[model samples]
Target: MSNKIKKKKMKKRWKISALVLVIIAIIGVVGYVGLQNFLKWKAPELSGEPKVGEWYRITPEGTKSANGKDWHSLIKVGKENKVIVYFFGGGLAVDEYTAARPLNDDGGFYADYADVDFGVKFGIASNNKENPFKDWTILAIPYSTGDLHAGSGEYEYTDLNGNKQILYHNGYINYTSFMKEAMKYIPNPDTLLIAGFSAGGFGTSLLADDIITQYFPQVNNVTVAVDSSLLLTDTWHDVAENMWQTPKEISDRLVSDNITLDSLTSLSKKYGNKIKILFGSSLRDEALSTYQSYFRNGILSTTNENGDIYEKDLAKMVADLQENIPNVGIYIWNEIEKNKDGKNLTPHTILPSPNFYGKKYSEDKSIADWIVNAVNGNINSYGLDLLDK
Candidate 1:
C-alpha cells in the first residue's frame, strides 16, 4: 500500500472514533434528562383549610420521593406567630430499599404517628397543653433518600449481595422545595424553631446555616435544635460524605473554616456564637448505636466483653463538639424511667420521650421550659443535662 493512502486511512479512523465518543456523550445526557423529567413530582394541592388543631398529611410542594414515589410531610396550621419546623426520625442506610420511611400517604414516617393526628413530646408532637410550643405552626418533614436528609449527588449503593443500586441523594433539593412552600404559610415568623431527630436531625444541621443566612436572614429569633442524630459516629462519616455527596451538596453553604466530614459539630463549629444550636441524645441510645453497627460493624465494634465500645467514642465526640461550638448547649439523657432491656441506663432520643415536656430538668423547669426560654431570645449556652432516675 502507498504511504499517502495509509495516512489517509488513519485519519479517517481517528475521525470515526471521535464522532462515536461525542454521540455516546450526547445520548447519556439526553437519557438522564428524560428520566429526570419522567420522575419529576408535582406540587401537591395545599389550598384546603386544615382543621385548627388536626394534623394533616399535606405535601406543600408535593415533594416526590427520589424515585418519583409518593412522599409527604405532616402539617398543622395555627394562629400563633411562632413556627416550628421538624424532620422525622429514620435510620440512615445504604440499603434503603428496606428502610423505614413512609412509602405512601396512608402511613407516617414514625411508628407511633398517625396520618392526621398530633402526638406529644417528639419534634412533631406539640399538641399537649404542657408544651409551650403547642400553638406554633408545625411543619414536619419526612425522610426518604436515606441520605441523612442532606445529600445532593446521584450515587450508587451496593447491597450485601453485590448488586448495585442507583440512588438520588435529594435531601437538599427537598429542603429547598419544602422551605419555599413553608414560607407561604409561616412567612415572617416572630420565632422560628427548627428541630429533627436521627437522619432528619443531620438534615436540620446541614441546612441550618442557609435557613438563617439565606432563607430568613432577618428572623433573629431562630433556634436550631437537634435530636439524637449523633453526627459523631465517625465510623461512617466518610461514607456519608462520599455516598451522600455531602461536600458537593452543602460545603459552599457551610462557608466556614475546617468544616470537613470529620468534624462532629460541622454546623455549630462554623457559625460559632452567631447561631444558637441545641443538641440532645441519650448516652445509651440502643437503637441508634445498633444502627451504627451496620456501617462500622467491622471497624468500630459497639459491643465488647466490658461494655459498649462506642460509648467512649460517643463521649469523646460529644466533648469535642462542646469545645468546638461556642454557642451550643446539649440536653443529654443519661437515664430512662423504664428499661425494657434491663440495662442500667436506657434511652435513645430525648425529644420523643414524654420527658421532653414533663421531666424536670431543675426544681421547677422542664425541657419545654428551656426550649421556650431559648425561643424567646434569652439565649445562653453550656447546657448538659441528665434526667432524674
Candidate 2:
C-alpha cells in the first residue's frame, strides 16, 4: 500500500472515533439531568390567608396520606356559642374549595357558591363580629382529592403554594380519621356545628348521624345546615335514574327523595335541642338537574348495588322530615328573580347582585340574609334589605 493512502486511512479512523466519543458524552449528560429532575420534582404548594369576610386558621393540624405525605389543617374562628365546621361543595383541586367559587376555564355554576359564603358571613355578622358564642370556629376543608370538581364542578382549588390538602379517595368511610385529626385543632367540643352544601351537605347529614352519634357523643351541640344537598334516603335510589343526568333534576330528586334529613329528625329526639338543623332551598333550580345526572350515573348504582331509577323513588326525605321534626327548621325561597329583565331565574351559586367584589359571579343579598338568620337560631324572620338599605 502507498504511504499517502495509509496516512489518509489513519486520519479517517481518528475523525470517526472523535465523533463517537462526542455522541456518548452528550447522551450521558442528558440522562443525568433527567434523573436529577425526576428525583427533585414535587407538586406546587397552595397557601394563603383567609379573606376578610372569611375565618383565619388558629391551629394547623398535621395530616399523613396513605403514601405518607404530610399536610396541615387550617381554621377560621367564629364568635357565636356555635362553631361551624364547613365542608364545601365540589370544584377545583384543593385550596379554592373554601373560595366562593372555583374559576375554571369553562365557567362555574351552583347556588352553593352563594350558600357557603352567605352562611359563613351570616355566622360572622349575626354575632356582630363580636362572636357572642365562645370558642366558635369554622373549618373550611378544600377538595384536594377527587374528580368531583371537573367542568363546572370545580369547587376545591389549590394555588401556587403546595399547602391545601385533598380527601383520600377511600377516606369517606375513613373520614373519622380526618375528623379525629380535626378535633385536635378545634377550640372546644361542647359547641360545634357541622354543615355543608350540595354533596357536602349530604355528607354532613350522613356523617353527623353515623359518625357523630357513634363516636363524638360528647359534642352536646350539633347544627346541620344543608342548602340543596343531592343526598336522599337509600330507598330513593329506586327512582333515581335522573339523578345522574342534570343538576336541576338531581336537586328535585334529592328534595323529593327524602334521604338527607330522614335520619336527622330523630337526632333532636335523641339529643333534644342540641341537634338543630337549618335547611335552605329554592323552588326552581337547575343545579339539581346537573347533580341528578352526576349521581345517577351507572357507577354509584353499581357500587351501592342500587336498582335503576333512583332519583324518582327517593322519598321526599327532606320534605317528610320537615313535617315531623319540629326543631328541624327550613327556609324555602319561593320566588328567586334570576335576570334583570324578569326571566325565570334558576337558583344557582353564581349570583346577579352587585355585592360580590373579587368573585367570578354576581351576588344576592336575600340568600345571604337568610343564612345569617339560620346560623343565629332565628328561623322565622330573615332581616334582609333587598331594596335600598
On TM-score, the candidate that comes out on top is 1
Listed in order, each prediction's TM-score against the native is 0.70, 0.49
For candidate 2, the TM-score is 0.49
Q: For model 1, how does the per-residue alpha-carbon lDDT over 1-389 read when each residue is reduced to its tens digit?
A: 43234333332111101112222333454585653443332323456666666566666454455554555666677778777777765545443332222224332122211121222223236566776777888877766666666766666645336676555666666666777766765657777787776665766777676677766777767788877665333334454556667655464443332222233366666655556677666666655554454334312122331125345545655566667776456565555434444454334555544566777655455666666777765544323433221
Residue 146, model 1: lDDT of 60
The count of backbone overlaps in candidate 2 is: 77
Off by over 4 Å in 1: 1-45, 48-52, 60-62, 66-68, 94-124, 157-164, 231-241, 247-266, 269-272, 299-310, 336-341, 361-364, 378-389
lDDT of 2 by residue, 44-110 (tens): 2224533323443322233332112443333554443355555544421211322222323323322
Kindly give the stretch of ten consecutive residues in candidate 2 with the minimal lDDT sum.
Answer: 11-20
Ten-residue stretch with the least lDDT total in model 1? 11-20
Q: What is the number of backbone collisions in each predicted candidate, taken in the order shown?
A: 0, 77
